[model samples]
Target: MERVPLSVLDLATVRAGHSSTDALLGTIAVARAADDLGYRRFWVAEHHNMPAVASTNPPVLIASVAAQTRTIRVGSGGVMLPNHMPFVVAEQFAMLEALHPGRIDLGIGRAPGTDQMTAAALRGVSPYLTVEQFPDHLRAVLALLGDDRIDAGPTARLRATPAPESFPEVWMLGSSTYGAQVAAALGLPFCYAYHFAMGSDVDRALELYRSGFQPSPRFPEPYPMVSASVIAAATTEEAIYLAGPSRVMVQSLRTGRLGPIVSPEEAADLDPELPGTQYAGTAEEVVAGLDDLIERTGARELMLAGTVYDPATRQDTLARIAKAWGM
Candidate 1:
């Protein structure tokens, strides 16, 4: 089988004993490691009002990561479109593309990335836009980035400045079929949130994307990428041990009691079977699992999303995976 390109998605998770600054620094360290290891892109996530996640603003984090790394693409794992105006999103990413031409990606999603109250706070009641308006908003952003498909919208009267010499690579991010349909109709790359959804509807969604796709100027072919959780260690036992914290994190998210990531020992004691799908094991085992995932999903790229308590250990996990994957 052909080798699939790999990328990294970081949440800048705040570990139990660390401050937000530490988490941010740790993310930069991971970006540098990914750059050196030849990872295709380094993307940061946006989650608001989450005590465990520090990446609330993706454009700012993208700028920081881009400044600190060389030759690695930097972007948002996504910026949730419902929380901000399409023009603002376009301008922020356009400026980023101008600063780091050919090295920026503008991943967009429809979810608010936070609880309802927080989402409401982000977008006030008056003049509020519904989630159903996401396609229009997405088209606005695309048109602002110079996509010709949307030439007569309100955005046509405006431009996202400092108009980049080249536009950022735009991707649609979702865990289900809504995003797939929109991306297919618009002819944009689609990234399935397999890491978060744990493979639910992934195959069906990708199939829907491929079958319904219409060719856009920028992307003539359907590009489906899977974002999955991964953990690599010297031994299978060690990898499972390291994945404990993520298990606890997922449990917390399910129960709405979000908190900082705890130590694996603490996590093991808290919840033994909190569900998640991770390609966790020794490096070779992880590689095999990833190959199987690619075969199942027909994904052209893989974006690994692994969160651990220790930042250095996270970097080591990525390095091990890269070495085993022969990248």
Candidate 2:
């Protein structure tokens, strides 16, 4: 019966400029506002080679966001594991845990996080998008965060220290059943990307997770995090008015246009099919759509990404959404 925690998923879009600094400042401001408004966490997504989003390195962005806000957890909705070495990720997150103390989390994904072109640039020739190496990679990351050894020979004795006896809370991020099984087998919290991988079968994926769960040191019981898209507006009409530009961007994404995000004025006039896809409407309705997701999925958290362009309007929508659930 606990009310859900309100969180942010920043895709690092600049509200009014075209520089990384613009994106950084906007992100910091969003985090600060969310913190002041009593939200729980502020997370950044990882999308390599995407011009619209500047937060490719979540730890670096998390540090920046944490520095600006006195409270509020900051983390990666996930760091794609297939593109990097597990030990290095553990080290990076360990450093974050050191800097932020109890506010860091390390959500991991098995995908390459990009198309074939960007994937090749980031990972060279390694093939991690396949299901075969995913479980091993997940275990490797956990082991590196613990007392376990990474290298096996006499010269391979590497230990990650200042481990807090526990590091950042690790969550498995996925859009399919494969992610559920891996999270269950490893006994970590699982988060579903119902936000982008929209479908009716996510329930089945959650089922696979709960049924196969086994307790580990990190979690004595299965913990789930459900992620969904939100575009909260004051009057349903006004919310739609403010959400226009982002809707066009979503349209561009689906049509392979990948153009610059259109202005809000342009978006407000477009039809639903032209906007590509979304979860729009008033805050009251968004909560209703998310209600059974929390209960049925056994989610310990809900990560809502408000995909709007204007920072002021976006923050306003977030606060009202939090109040919608009485948070």
Candidate 3:
């Protein structure tokens, strides 16, 4: 069988001793490495007021990464639909598609990527749609991007502006079943946040997505990608050691006190069991884990997400995994 394609989801993690500039540069470096290593997609996330994450605006980062890389697809891990108008998102992604042509993707999510107060600031009295209205907004974006199946209602008269000959591929991103249902009904590709939810509801979400999938012109069949936290090193012990910062970060998040990602040395004293189900081991061992994940979830693609503090180590891990996966 052909090897399953691998992708990456990077948060431009800011380390304890590194500046945000360093974090942004690290993202570019990783994207370059992924592109050179023959990865399929490289997605950046959007988070506001998070010291550890520097990928605040995806389009800007996508443009930068796309410009630097040669072949890997660049896109948002997600742009929270509730945080911006459909037209606004459509316009940004439309422009990206025009510039990058076939190398752009627009992944949409429902929840705001930040606190409610920050979300309010992002909406800025523009009559932001509630989370309940996300499906409607997603449809509107699709319509603006030329998905004629959508009625678009009042959004019909609007255009994303500077429309291109092609549109960016749209994917629904979620950690729960609602996103799965929406993506299936709309006939769009879906990416389950398996890493964020710690492997919860993944089987149910993917099952629903495939069973209820309705084909659309852009996406004729169900395409599901599972996001997983992974770390690959020369030895299982080394991989576990490298995962220290991620464990600490997860613990901090659980306590509602997110902070900059600390070095592994700094996180040595923290509890090591709070993080999600991450694949951390030698390349062959990690590949076995990924193979098991594929068998269990039946995902077409896997988006690897590792919160390692050092960019060089992160890039190295990707290379190791790619080699092991024969990509």
Candidate 4:
């Protein structure tokens, strides 16, 4: 089989002893590297009230990264659509598309990207929203983006301003079969969050997406992507050591105690178990694992999310992965 295109997903992780500013800077550096390496896309994630993650506002970060790099499609790995009005999301991405032209993606997700209380604060209301409303929210966003006609309150006939002739590509992001079904039903691209959903039946989700897919003007065929956590180093032992901090970060998140990502030494003390979503090994091992993942999920694209304590190590991981994949 032909090798699939590789992409990147970054959380702009704030490591121990580092400020959020440092993490954001590191993100730009990573974006430049990914662009130079010929990666297909560079995506930033959104998370609120999390000290470990610095990418709370994906559009702002996307603008910043897009300014620093000339290529490598910049976008939200996704924006949690439930946290804001669909109109605002549409305007923001429309502006981004107008500025960047053919290099913007608007990956949308249903999760709040934070705890219930924090989500309520972000949404400026009591927390009552559910993921079941995602399809409606998505449709509203599309309508505002000029894909459909919806009654605009007060300004009942206005379209989202600066709506470029070419709009950003929209991809649905999810960790469950429901997201797959929604993407297939809507005829949009689907990106499975395999990096975070360690135990999810990704193959089944992709199969469901393919089986239920209905062709639409935006997508003539199903375009499926899978995101994974990877750590590629010179050797398997070194890779495991390099992945220590990420393991600790995952454990903290799992336990609802998310905080600054720790150093390798601190992570070593915790000795957290490696999550199934993560693959920490030599470049060859990572390549083999990625091959298996592609075969199983039949994903046309692969997104690598590597959150390590050191920016240099993270860059090295990307470099090694790119070389192994011959990108």
Q: Please give the clash total of every predicted structure, in order.
A: 0, 0, 0, 0
Expressed as tens digits, the lDDT of each residue in 1-327 for candidate 2 is: 578676777777755346767777878888898898888778887888766777788888888888888879888988988777667788888988888888988989888777877776776754545335667766777777772433323323554455664578788889999899988887888888878777556888889999999888658788777887777776777766666776677776777766444557766666444442255678887677678667777676788775666667668777777788887
**TM-score-based ranking, best first?**
1, 3, 4, 2
- Alpha-carbon RMSD, candidate 1: 1.4
lDDT of each: 0.90, 0.75, 0.91, 0.88
| lDDT agreement of model 3 with the native | 0.91
Q: Give the winner by TM-score: 3 or 4.
A: 3
Q: Give the per-residue lDDT digits (tens) of candidate 1, residues 144-219.
A: 8888878646657888999888999999999999899999999999999999887489989999999999998889
- What lDDT is reached at residue 17 by model 1? 80
Reference-based TM-score of each model: 0.97, 0.90, 0.97, 0.95
Q: Which residue runs of candidate 3 sit more than 4 Å off their true CA positions?
A: 125-129
Q: Which stretches of candidate 1 lie over 4 Å from their true place?
A: 126-128
**Positional deviation of 100 in candidate 4, in angstroms?**
0.3
- Local error of candidate 3 at residue 40 (angstroms): 0.3
Looking at model 2, residue 118 earns an lDDT score of 76
What digit string (tens of lDDT, one per residue) describes model 3 on residues 87-122?
A: 999999999999999999999999898887888888
Q: List residue ranges in candidate 4 displaced over 4 A.
A: 130-132, 149-156, 274-277
TM-score of 1: 0.97
Model 1 Cα shift for residue 151 (angstroms): 2.8
Q: How close is candidate 4 to the true structure, as a TM-score?
A: 0.95
